[model samples]
Target: MEKHILYTTEAVNQDGLNGQSFIKTGGLTVTVSNPLNNKPGTNPEQLLGLSLSTCMNATLQAIEREHGLAHTAEVRVTVTLIKEENFAFLVVARVRIPGVPLKTATKLVALAKKRCPVSKLLSGSSYYQVQVVEDY
Candidate 1:
């Protein structure tokens, strides 16, 4: 078995009607709460979507830099959580790689999907989901 690296995050929440938690990690803080609570904060679902898209984008950016390529990609990830019997979530990763060939862009996104750690954890292959899109 391979050794596992641990990551830590802390959230502080107070007991109240308008209670929300702030997760602190890596010198940054993310405030989260349920939408039903009506408090002003980012929800967990939104954060999850953001994390996945950001990870994929970062991975692709790394690949671009490695190849000394010009231009960059802008990524937007929308995650939908379906309330079903089991864990059901769908992620739509829309990416726009301007000035790059369609074939190259598609290939980079494919590699990102395969290598992104968050995408690995939340596999989209087992369900009816479109993981990546190449937006012109």
Candidate 2:
């Protein structure tokens, strides 16, 4: 199979978790800070959760539209940073599709998990999971 490039963007983080991170395109910038601290900034865990939740929900919306259903999917991503022998993150994406049956929602989530770029990037890790839930 041939690979075709669609769109690309670059993000630069200069001071790790203590300063700022911005897009090379100059569109967005975010203050970075350690989650353990009380500083008002965004941490990696929160950023990861946002990315997964947004990507998964967007994918679910597209699938729902294709099936002639209204956009009613909600995705909640919980990211936990664990420290043992090494630092690892446990990511769980909880998805709820209101007005849709459990079976159908489950199928839609499964498909979204496969289609979402963030989900695919994390799918190989045992710490990542996507589940269909009755409530958001």
Candidate 3:
């Protein structure tokens, strides 16, 4: 598989406060709220919150399927941002898995941390390239 796969989505309603965006897949709807920051776009903090929740949820599902156990997994993500000297965000995730063995839960958490796409991306270093285009 290509490391840099291309994923595309469309956004309309540019006049809204956050450019209301939503994607429809199958029978589900996913919406993103524009963060009220200076950038006036989807904030990284919100995306981080989503990513962490997704990873932890997948791990719980894997454990349930493998062990034939039933439980609800509630993930709480707290994000802190520092924008004074430099821009930074800290995401702390607390996963609640009831009726699961401590060791098994730990294993699942570790595996999820390793396998989650967002976790992997955040763990590695990233930089953005910017370019300015002019109309011909």
Error of 2 at 49 (Å): 0.9
Per candidate, the number of residue pairs that clash is 0, 0, 0
Each prediction's TM-score versus the true structure: 0.72, 0.96, 0.59
Q: What would the per-residue lDDT of candidate 2 be over residues 1-136, giving only the tens digit for each residue?
A: 9999999999998899999999999898999999888999998899889999999999999999988999999998999999989998999999989999999999998999999999999989999988889975
Q: Model 1 misses residue 88 by how many Å?
A: 3.6
RMSD of 2: 0.9
Collision pairs in model 2: none
Ranking by lDDT: 2, 1, 3
* lDDT value, residue 112 of candidate 2: 96
* Candidate 3 wrong stretches, greater than 4 Å: 1-43, 125-136
- lDDT on C-alpha atoms for all candidate structures: 0.70, 0.93, 0.58
Candidate 3 global lDDT: 0.58
Among all windows of 10 consecutive residues in model 2, the one with the lowest summed lDDT is 127-136
Better of 2 and 3 by TM-score: 2
Candidate 1 structure quality by residue, lDDT tens digits, 6-68: 966676656332445555543545556665577777766687778877887888888788778
